[model samples]
Structure formats: C-alpha cells, structure tokens
Target chain A: MNMRCTKARRYLSQAMDEQLPPAVTRQLDEHLDACRECRDFREDLALGRRLLGATEPSLSGNFDWRLQLKLNQALQKAAGETAYPWLEEKPRGRGWAGNFTTAAAFGLAAVLALAMFIGPQGRVMPDDAGRYAGFETSRQVAGGVSDRLPLNRGALAPLSAPRGIQRSVSGSFGLGDFSPNAAFVLDSGWSGNHLKDLATIQELKLRNQRLNNQLYQYQQQISILRRQLDRPDSNGLDLGR
Target chain B: MNPSRDEHRHGSPSAARFDLVETRDEDLIVMVQDGNRKAFDELAARYKNRLFSFILRMVKEPVLAEELTQETLIRVYIHAGKYREIAKFSTWVFTIATNLVRNKMRQRSRRPQLLSLNPAPADDEIPLDPADPVADPSEEIQRRELALVINEATAAIPEKYRIPFLLREVEQLSYEEIQQVTGLKLGTVRSRINRARNRFRQLIKPLLKDETLLAELEMIEARVAEQKDNPS
Candidate 1:
C-alpha cells in the first residue's frame, strides 16, 4: 500500500461522520478508486456504521412516567431542604420532634436561670447568704477547733456587733479586727495574689512577644534563602557540591 | 389565583401562556431554576428516550439503564441552577449520564462475573415491519443472523471505543460534543471511534463474507455506477 492508502483510511472514518473537508474528500475518492484494499475497508466501515445505526433502541413505554416520578421526588426533597436546612439535619419524620427537643432545651435553660436569680425567699440575697451559710457550717463541723460565732450571721447581720465581741471573734477566727490597719493588711494579701497573677500573665505576654519576633526573623531569613535558591547561581553551587 | 383556571375562564389556551414545548432546553433549564416544575418535566420528557437509549447501550441492561437514566435526570433537576449557558444543555446532561454509566461499569468490574462481555440483545430493538413482504424466508433468516452478529460484535467492543462509537453512530453527537460528554480530547475521540469501527469489522468479517452481504454490496456498487452514468 502507498501513503495515499494510509491517508485514505483516515479519511474513510472521517467521511462516515461528514467531518472531512471537501479537498480531503476529493483526494479520498481518487485514492479509493485506484486502491482496492482501501475501497473494501471503506465499504466495511460503512456497513458496520449502518448496522449499528439500525440497532438504535427505542425506549420502553413507561420510561417517561417512571423518570418523571423519580425526578419529582428528588426535586421535592431538594426543595424541602432548601426551605428548611434544619429539616435535613433530622431524619425523615423527625422534624417536629427536633423542634420539640429544641423548645424543651430552651425551657430548661430559662427555668434554671429563673431559679438561680429568684430563690424561694423571692430575693437574690437569700441565695448568696444560703451558699455562704453552707460553706461556714461545713467548715465549723469539720474542724471543731474554734469556739467562734457563726460568721454568716455576723456577715449578714447589721454592723452593730460590740467591739469586745468583734475582738473576741477576730481572735478566735485568727483574723485581725475590722479596723483600717486590719483592712490594709487584708488588702495587701489580696493584692499580693492579684499581682502574682498579673506578673505571670505579663511574663507570658513577653514570651509570646519574643516568639513573634523570632518568627518574624525566621520568616525573613526564609525569604532571603528562597530568593537565593531561586537565582541561577544556586545551580552552580549545587554542581560544585 | 390559579393561572390555568384563570386562562380557561378567559377562553385562552394554557399553552399560550408559556409555550414550554417550543422553548429551548437551556431556557427550560433556566425556568426550572426559577422553580418551574412544568419546564423541568418538559426537559425530562424531551431527553428521556435519548438518555435511556444511550445508557442502555453502554450498560446492556434495561433495568440498570432505566435507573441510571432516572438518576441522571434527577441530578439535572437538582442542579438546574448550576447550569451555565456557555455549554450546551445537552452536553451537560449527557456528561452526567456518561459519568453515571462509567461509575456503574467500574462497580460491575469489581465483580467480574457480573460483567458479561456479551449481553443479551437489547430489549427495545425496533421490530421489523410486518407489512413489508420478505422476498424469501431464507433471506430473512440470513438477515436476522447478520443482525445478531452485528449486535454481538458491538457488545464485544472495548468500553473505551464503544462509548464514543455509539455516541457518534447512534446518538449522532459531534466529535467535540462527544469529547465534552466523555471528557476525552478530540483526537482521542476520533481515534477511539476509528478503532471501534476496525474492531467491529474484524469481528464481523466472517458474516461479511456471507452471500447476502456480498450481494448487498454488489447492489450498492451497481447503484453507485448507475448514478454516475445517469447523473440524476
């Protein structure tokens, strides 16, 4: 076979789909006329195409209805999800149950908040006083070391305790008397704890600032290294290595 | 107001309101995006048979083909809003259908026994017209046998070629459109189709040597010669 035969066979396939240019068509026709092998190849390909085309299957009768039903269901499902995203979060038939669960959760939260704010005495002070009373009672019973008066009563009562009683209570509880000097001492202790916390926080902040500065320096070094590596001279360095 | 009822009350045809049948597939898809159920149904009805035929040929199982066709249309409906006007709507839909067929083929390949190389003849072959009288019973039998050989040969073609071949031959898609559907380059599509044709010729060569086919070829050649002489 000649080169025309090769070109003609390629044109044969293209011609089946009417994809060949007119110039190529003329050349293919001439080649087919002169070449028996190319002509037979063309004819066989044509016959195969025709048979395949003839076998094109018709769709079954119920195809449209079946497809439409499925498509409608899918569209409806998509629509439901779009309308309410929470519907998708719950399984089918559990939509209302989901809402009910949410409502119950909010109701429980509100009830807890109301109980914390408004105790049985209808005042917030009673709740705070009761908590302090529980703590003092636990400490007194557990230790049984001091014959001190209950601090809860003294703390909640009007500031009308006699000075002698206050002094005795302060000695028994190992606390200084409620005087300006005593207040200054307590303030110093409280400030000491607060200052220690502040110092630790400041130390952490300083360390974080140092780390950020180091990170910035490393990043700058990386950028410089990247620029050097990107240069063509880096190739020479590698070759020398 | 109920639009159909209002149209009837005004003594106007319902089709005059929208004229969905005359609308293009892309416009129909746009309408579907705008929540038009009728438009979606129109698109589905238009492509149902063609899509089913393409999938059926690829998978060679009617039930699976039907399922795949339904899934493909459902995907189009769900993703109607994502359709861009740059590509033809038919190309996009066929891409979905082709992908589904490819996935099913992949799944079937996992269980090789289920992947029959030669499936039964498609269920929906166009029945031969009974009104046309046969010249002879023997000739008719030979024609049917020839058809059987053709079907078997087509089924035996490799999936890579068979898809483009059927898309070109039966569905009448252009090379570029076939490329879009199958995601193969234009050159690959053409080469695969050519290889498919050659493979089919090789498989059906024995049948081609039969007397009936030779006679048919002779008649075709004779007609061509007569046409050349007459120049009608």
Candidate 2:
C-alpha cells in the first residue's frame, strides 16, 4: 500500500460517518477499486462498525427505582436549601446581639423617662412662710407690691402647708395648686396640658419597651432555629450516606 | 370507529382548536429550570438508557456506570438553571458524562489494585436481527462469541481513540457534537475516530478468518458502497 492508500483509508472511515465530501469519496472509491490492500482495509472498517454497533448495553430492571430514590432525596435537600439559604451557614451571632441591643435601647429610653419624672421631684423646695414674707417685704421696699405674682403654683407649691393656707395663698396669687405626688410635672409657669402630655409620653415609652423585649425574644428563637438547621444531622438527611 | 378516533381522523372542530403538544428536550429542560419535578423525571427517563450505556462502556463496570449515571442526572437536575440553549442538550449531557469518566480513569490510574476487579457480569444478550430466522443454534453461539471478541478488542483500544469511537459509532453523535462533548477540534475528532477504527480493525482481524464472518463483512461492504453511490 502506498501513501495514497493510507489517505484513502482515513477517507473510508469518514465515509461511514457521512463526513466526507463527494470529491474525497470518489477518490477513496477509485483507490479501493484499484488497490486490493485498501479494499481489505475498507472491509475491516465496516466489520468493526457492525460489531460495535451490535454491542450496545442496557440497564437492569431495578436501575430506575434506585436512582429515583437518590434523586428525590437530593432534590428535596436542594429545595430546602433554596427555600431557606440561612440553613447553609451559621446564623451570625451579630443578628441576635443586634436584637439584644435594640431591647437595651428601649430599656434605656424607659429609664430616661423615669428619670425625667423623678429627678425634678427630689429637688422640690418646701414652701417657707419666712421666705414668702421676706419676698413680699423686699417687693414692697423695691417698688409698689402687685396684687398677684406670675409663679407656677402646681410645681412650686409647699406640700408642708395646710390645705386651707395652700388654697388661700394660691387663690390670692392667682395660681393653680396641684398635688406634690403627681406622677409627671413640668417647670413652673407651664399649663396643666403640659403635665398631661408628659404623662402620655412616659406611658408610650413603657409600651415601646415591652414591644422591643418581645421582638428580641422572637429574634433569639429564630437564630436558635437557624443554628439548628445548619447542623448536618438536624434534618435527618445524611448527605454523606 | 371509536368517537375519539373518528374525531381525530376527521379533524374535528375541537381538535383543530388545540395544537398538538410535542415537547422537545430543550423545552423539558426549561421546565426543569422552572422547578417542574415532573419535567425532571421525564428528562431522566429519556436519557437514562443512553447515559448508562455510554458510561458503562467508558468505565467497564456496571455498578460504577450506574452510580455515575445517577450522579450525572442529579447534577443536571441541580444545575438546570445553568444550561444555556447555545449547545445541544445531548452535547452538554455527554460532556458531563465524559468528564466524570476522565475523573474515574484518573482515580483508577492512581490505585492499580483497585482496578484489578471487574465484578459486573458480562452482557450476554445476543443481537440477533429480528428479520433473520435462527436456523441453527451453533450460528447463534458463533455470533455471541464474535460479539464478546469484539467487546474485548474495543476495550483494548487506547482511551483517547476509544472515546471518540464510542461517541461516534455507539452513541451515533455527529462529529461536531463529539467535538463539543470532548472539547477537541474538528480535525482532531475526525483523526481520532479514524485511528480508532484502524485499531479496532487490526485487533479483530484474527477473528474474521471464519467464512461466515467474512461473508457478513462482504455484505456490509457492499451495503456501504451502495450507500456511498446513492449519497442518501
């Protein structure tokens, strides 16, 4: 066989696959007809294809059943992870800490509101009769004394004085007296509405603190569940097996 | 005639209103990407036999082939969203199976002892042409023996050539499709398949001395020549 025979042999294989151009097929056919060696090679190639084609294998009967089980397990796991990506990683400790911080903030706000209520009450000054008398005499000496003063009686009233004295003094001064044990109070010269507004604000602060605590506990539970889901054994789907 | 058959044959008004639904593999795969489990099952059922045969021939072990086939299908199911329609679905699937075979071959090469056993039972099914009557039991036995010899000869071929050969002859993949699956250039795929055929011919030459086999070869050559002449 010459070099042309070798080339023709390659063309023969391509011809079987329907890959050869018409020109090459004609050249190969001409070579095969003239060369006995190339004809034998062509025969061998055809025989090999026939034998290989006949040997295609088939799977056993139970193949699909077994594969289906494994596939279902894998798909289910994939779906679960897709639905909750947090299950793939550890729930960050920062998330739970953030919730705790928010709760702490609410508590701080409540404390600040309580302080606003109690801080001014501790500094309450007793209504001294001598002080009032001195103040009246000074006013008279300085200038002609007015019939009334513009002081806030509710916040500055002397609790130590009798009710009658307190009433008489406040009435003469044209100021409204309020209870010393009032839950919320503003500075003197403010209206009664101001005190009511402060009390409403303190009530809202307490409610906000309660809601924040509830939210913090719920977040903590979610973090715990996320951590559990991240564990390999938690879902009872042993991936390694 | 049955009422549905009469309706179908006569092209009834209701039948004309609905188009026939013939889902292609790409459409089924798109459905899979959309999280349709039934579509996934359909895809798996469609490719299981072809994939198992290809992987089995590559690995030469039934159990490993079955495992690899399942792994390939599972990978497809999980990564359905990654598939692009630029390539044929078969090309993509065969590429995955081929990569897995390469990995298994590499692992086997590392541990020679592990490769010593091939416990899977040999495929004993005969490929008797249904059109031909079995006139003699001896002839059937001869065909089976010839098939076994051919299987051994194929297994003896170099892995580089054997893969392209199987992809072409067994799987009936086009040269371009084989190129995509193997990541080889067009010229390389052509040459590898040619060399594989040459090698297979040399290996099986001794077995072809039988008169019956030679006659079969002649018939095959004549048929091939006819096909060439007709160019169909």
Candidate 3:
C-alpha cells in the first residue's frame, strides 16, 4: 500500500473506537470515502469487533449472593487471623501434624468461617454465621511455596491508617487497606531483616564486581609482561618483574 | 460492551453518603473509603459481570474467571481506602483484575491443561438475551460454530496483545484507559491493538468470506426484521 493508504489504515482502528480527535476524525472520514481499501478495512475490523463482543458469557444471576457469602467469609477470616497470627504464618514448619493443622485451620476456617458483617453495634454479623453455619470444609488448597509464604508485613505498615491489611488471594504481594495493626507491623522482622538482607546482597554484588575488575587489571599486566619476555627482541628489563 | 447489568437489584440501607446508583464510581469509592461497606457492594454490583467477562476471555475458564472476579472485587473492597483519586476507578479495578488473570494464567501454564470440546457452563449463567440476533434455531446452530472459531482466534492472540485488544474490543475501554490499565504507552497500546486486530482478521478471514454463511446470516436478519415490523 502507498503511504496515504498506510496512514489512513493506521487511524482506522482508533476511528472504530471513536478515539481520534475531531479534526483527525474528519480527515480520516475523507480518506475512507475516497479510498475503497481503507473503507473495506474499517468494515472488516468493525465486523470482527461485533463478532467477538457477541459471545459475552454473562455473570450468574445470583452473583450478589455468592459475593456476599465470599465477603462474609473474608471478614470472618480477617478476624480469625488477627486473633491468631501464627495460624497465618507460612507452612515452613513441616510434618504431618503441621500440614494437617494448617490444612485443618484452613478447612475449619472455611467451614466454620463466619460469614460476618459489621452490625449497627459495630459487632460482627452473627446472623450470617448462623445462615452459613455449615460452610465448605474443603482443604486449604495451597499453590506450593508462594502461597504458603506470608506477605511482607513491613511493606504494608505505612497504609495502616484504615483497617487491617489483607492480602488478595492471588495478589499475594499486594498490601491493601484493611483492619488496623500498625503497631504489630512496625515491630515485625519482615521489614527490617528483609531490608538488611537485601542491602547485604547488594553490597556483596558490588564488592564482587570490584574484585573482578582488580583481578582483570592484574591479569592484563601479567599477560603483557609474558608477551614481552617471550619476544626475542625483548630487552632483559621484562625479566625484572 | 454495555452488556453488563448490576447484580444488586435491592439496594442496601447503608451507604449514607449519596445515591450509590447515581454517583460516579470515583465518588462511590470515596464513600467506600469513608467506611461505608454498602458503597463497596454497589461498586461490586456494578463491576462483577464486566470483570468476570473480561477475565473469562483471558483465562478461558468460567470457574476460574468467577473466582478471579470475586478475588479482584474483594481486593477492591478491602483496599478501598488505599485507592487514590490519581486513577479512574475502572482503571484501578481492571488493573487488579488483570493481575489476577495474569497470575492464574501463569499458574495454569505450569501444568498442561486438556481442553474439553464441550465444557459445562456454571449453573447460574444468565440466560441469553432474547434480542440477540442469532436467536433463530438455524442461526443459533451456525452462530455456535462461528463462536468456536472466534474463541480460538481470541485464545490465539498473544498475551501482551490479548488484554489490550480485549479491553478495546470487549470491554470497550478507551486507548487512554487501556494504557492506564495495561501500563502501556498510548502509541504502544494502539499498535498492539492494530497487530491483534490484523491477526484476528487474518485468522477469521475465511469465515467472513464464506458467502453462503453471509447470505444465510443476511436472510436471518431480514426475517427477524420482518417479524419485528409485523409482530405476528
């Protein structure tokens, strides 16, 4: 295609989204009117967009109910976690009982997990707990090491003004607004030791690089001297090294 | 797609700040930050389907999509206070959704997954819209086949292009919004979308060119139009 056709086609997608400025849009319309190829390109892209958008699989009708259940569970779990931080710790401690306890904690937490809400008295919603009294007893399905590791508590300390911090399911690294616990976060090793370890690692990395550079300089000097000594025209001065 | 409807039909008694339905998402989120849990419910109601649909297209599994949508919404709820007015609420929400989708996709990639030709859909799936053009039986059958082809084309688009492309074509987000969502430059977003569109166009070119299908589709639309006009 010629430059004009290329430029017009470049703007075709933006035009489809109605994203182009009015002036650019007018110019694009002019191009499309004059050019059959650009016109066809726009039509084809529009058809594609229409076809893809047609297959929208809608959310279930009872979506809100399901979400409410999940939210209640989250609130209850948050409360349970605050009461027992060790339960929230990583599963580095191995063995049958360790695994079972953690798993049971999760399963029980899942089943007995109160679907709680804040009532007018600022009390946990006891009614939901009764409604979903028989909660799912599914085992804590941890996705290997990453799932087991606790979130970096220190990274979460600054934003403690709201509620306590809760990690999103898959967003394990992300720290968000939640229950209030700034005091605990400040004293935790997650920030201090983690920072110290990182600094140590970085320093080591830099020192290693410096040593390698010094060694390279020594090796270069040795190589130059050896070359001079090997040459028949070399003066005995090369041997003084 | 303007296809999503808020699932919360009954409004809650709380959310005393303003009319949750009438308020902008940004304002609603501010109320959420201000300790109104109902405001978050309103936000979740507004976003659940849209997020589910967007994630489903990426992950290609309904259950996983539902889980991710819930997780993303929960993050939005729990983290409402942390969210600043620096970005659009939709942009921020999609960013969280995108993260979950990427994480799930990464985890799924580790193990080989077998694709079932006909997977059972979740129980609560909303019924198909009656106004859908492919409502007739003959059109329905043809459309199913077409849908399979289109789905494959969608899955085939590379990950980087896929999100931006879907956000554009499916979510109908503006280029600027998409740039914010994907953390891509404006020009980069446009070019990637262009590449994706070009690739999809190429893959589905034969289907579009199938004159018989086109003619049949045209006939179906004509018949539907006639029915609408006559109402008998």
Candidate 4:
C-alpha cells in the first residue's frame, strides 16, 4: 500500500471498532486480508495496548481506609439527625406508626364513649367531671394540642351524658371547659345530641379495629418468616443408615 | 454479562469459583444495606483505585481526586438506605462519580480565566540514566518522542470523548457499563472510544517510523495471520 493508502487503511481499521454491524466487520476483515500495510497498522495497535497494560491503576496506599472512614462518618451523621425515618427502611407500606395512631384514636374514643351516652338527658347532676377530665386528657394524648378540638356536637352527646343527671351536669359545663377559644365553644344545644356521638365513636372504633388487625397480620407474617429461617435443617435428619 | 441466562452445560467447579470471585454487585448492595461495614469497605476497596485513577486523570489533581473519591463513597453510604437492588452496584457508584466529575468540570468551566489544563508532567517524567546513556540517541529519542506524543493526544481529546475513551481503554469497563456511567447511549460510547483510539493511533504513527519496532509489530501480525491460517 502507498503511504497515504496505508494511513487511510489504518483509519478504516480503527473505525471498525465502532462499526460492528456484521456487514461492516466483514468488509473491514476483507480489506485487512488484502492490505499488508493495514495489517501492520493493526499490529501496532495491539502492541500499543500490550505495552499500556503495565500502566493499570494501582490503589493509593490509604484509599480504602480513607473512603471507608468518610462513608462511615456520613452515614453516622445521617443516622444521628432526624430525617424521615420512613425513608431509611425500604418502602413497604404504611407502617406500625400509622396503625398505632388509628388505634390510639379509637382508645380515645372508647374512653370518651361514656360522654356521649350521658350528655343529653337533662337530669342535672354533678358527677360528669371525671368523664370530662378523662376525655380531655385522652384527646390531648392522642392528638396534639391544637387551636381546634375536633368537636362533633352530635357525636358528643351520647358520650358526654349517659343519664339525665349527667346530661345536666355536663350541660352546666356545656363544652366550655373543652374549648380554649370561647366564641367557638360548643353550646348547651350540642349537649343534647346523643345518637351522633355514638355514631362517631363507633366509626372511629371500626377504623381502629381494622388497622389493629392489619398490624397484627404483618407482625404474624414477619414472625413466621423469622421462625422458619431460625429452625435448623438438621442436615436432612442424619441417621446411621 | 448475562451469566444467569446461560445454560450451565460446560463450566465446572473452577468456573463457578471464578464467577464467585467476580462478585455480583447486587450482593454487595444488599450487604451494605444490611449495615455490614466490612462489606461496604470491601466494595469501596474494589473500585477505589480505578475510580481514583479516572478522577486523577480527568481533574489532573491528586488532592482533588482524593476528595472526589471520598465524596463518591459518602454518596454511596448516605444513599445505602435508598439503594434499589435493580442495578449493578458498580454502575450506581460510577454514576455518582460521573456526576461529581461533571459537576467539577462545570464549576471549572464557569471560571473566566483559562486555568492550566493538565498537571505538570515533570513530576512523573523519568530522567535518563547517566550510568549507561544511549550512545546513538535516535532510538532513545524515538521512545521519549512517542511517549510525549501519546500524552498530548490523550490530553487533547475533548471531554465528551475522553471519558468514554478512558473508561473503556484504561478502566476496561464494557461498553454497556460505560454507557451507564456516562448516561450516554451505547452507540455514542462506542463511537467515542473508537474516535479516541483512532486519534491516538494517528498521533503515534509519525514516531513509529522506527524500523525496528515497526518490523517487530509486522512479525507479530504475520505470526497471528499464520496461526489463523493453520487452526489447532
């Protein structure tokens, strides 16, 4: 091959690395077979690679330890700080916390259950202080102290007053003690609603029950998997046969 | 690459052992996620050198390479909780490193002044031996000339092509992995690698006028051709 042609062939040979369709590879191979200069160019390419092999990268002496320390520190910092805890675990589904909140709401409603039963009877008595204190405490525990008390007046009656005396006693208080804000404080009219209070408690209890069941099932499945893995295989129950 | 898809018809125990040593990247990820610090250390140890060299070559600064390597590992650690086992760990790590390098490149680019590109070659340049120096200087001169030409050619390759080129040629990542790391299409990666190699070849062709090295290469080619002509 002429000098120009030899260089051109070398270019084509290099191009073959990128042009690997069967047709292109075939054409390049055929050209290489006929062209001595191109074949020689290919040899130089291979020799360059072989010589360059000696220069493979070696790890710096402290690379591993340095990187490992950096990684550990970063992870430690991340763990120490408050982040979305849900983000750390693989996103499976809403977790125990979700169900726990629901269950807690139900527990609050159950304690408040008596308030609805007694709130509306008009039997003017003074023994409702315990139920009021309990309901308020439970609400404060289950839900954070906020500007609003989430009062459903219709739902409050049955739980607020189980009997007429209790109803009258609670009526004197008239949801005033529950409200930090006065204008929004519920009235005596709200004390007379019994059926709505029962309905709300029942609704909350149902939801809480469902969540509790789901939480239980998840726990059970996890335990079953753990137990199965924990059991020894006994090496196929070896016997001197 | 698709070892799982292959039928286990030929390979024996030794081949299986080789495969084990190759390390399924997903296993490493699972280990790291499980809070296995030693496994994480192993993962870092496996790729740190190659990744450091890549960063060093691109940034041309040892201290910067060290920082980037540390940053890459930190990213991996922080993201361990978020790691999806769907991809190879090496691909994920390289993707992180690639982003860091690209960000550094962008930051460097934003500077108005054209900062000097490569590190001073003198630090690595070897002095000729005084005890038995070459008498007829042409051959010794040719080697130095070739080395200098090769360095210039490699350094001159544009950033777009240089990464794929270096990863494929120097780091020996497969074209698929190069594409994953670079976030480029497979065809583009191959094209860039080819372009880089061809550029290097073109650069080296002038210095290769040395008759002796040229003859040796030709002899190697003839031997290869002869072996092909007569298959065992």
Kindly list the per-residue Cα lDDT of model 3 for residues B15-130, writing each as its tens digit: 21235687788877765664457668889988887898788878876667787898999888878888898988999999999988998888878966666755666555432334
TM-score of 4: 0.50
Off by over 4 Å in 2: A1-3, A80-241, B1-21, B115-147, B212-232
Q: Model 4: runs farther than 4 Å from truth?
A: A1-23, A83-241, B1-22, B112-152, B204-232
In angstroms, the error of model 2 at B70 is 1.7
- Among the numbered candidates, top DockQ falls to 2
* CAPRI tier for the interface of model 2: incorrect
Scored against the true structure, residue B63 in model 1 reaches a CA lDDT of: 74
**Most accurate candidate by TM-score:** 3
* Candidate 3 TM-score on chain B: 0.73
Order of the predicted models by TM-score, top scorer first: 3, 1, 2, 4
lDDT for each residue of candidate 1 in B1-232, tens digit (9 for 90 to 100): 1233223223244434557788788877876665556778899888987887788778876677778888998899888879998888998999999888998999888866544675765654322234224235664454445545566787799999999988888788899999988889998999999888888899987867677676754544454466469764
TM-score of the second chain in candidate 1: 0.68
Over all chains combined, what TM-score does candidate 2 have? 0.55
How does each model score on TM-score?
0.55, 0.55, 0.56, 0.50
**How much is the lDDT of residue B11 in candidate 2?**
38
Off by over 4 Å in 3: A19-30, A91-241, B1-17, B114-146, B210-232
In model 1, the Cα lDDT at residue A182 comes to: 39
Candidate 4: which docking quality band?
Answer: incorrect
- The lDDT per prediction is 0.65, 0.66, 0.66, 0.56
Candidate 3's chain A scores what TM-score?
0.34
**Number of backbone collisions per candidate:** 0, 0, 6, 19
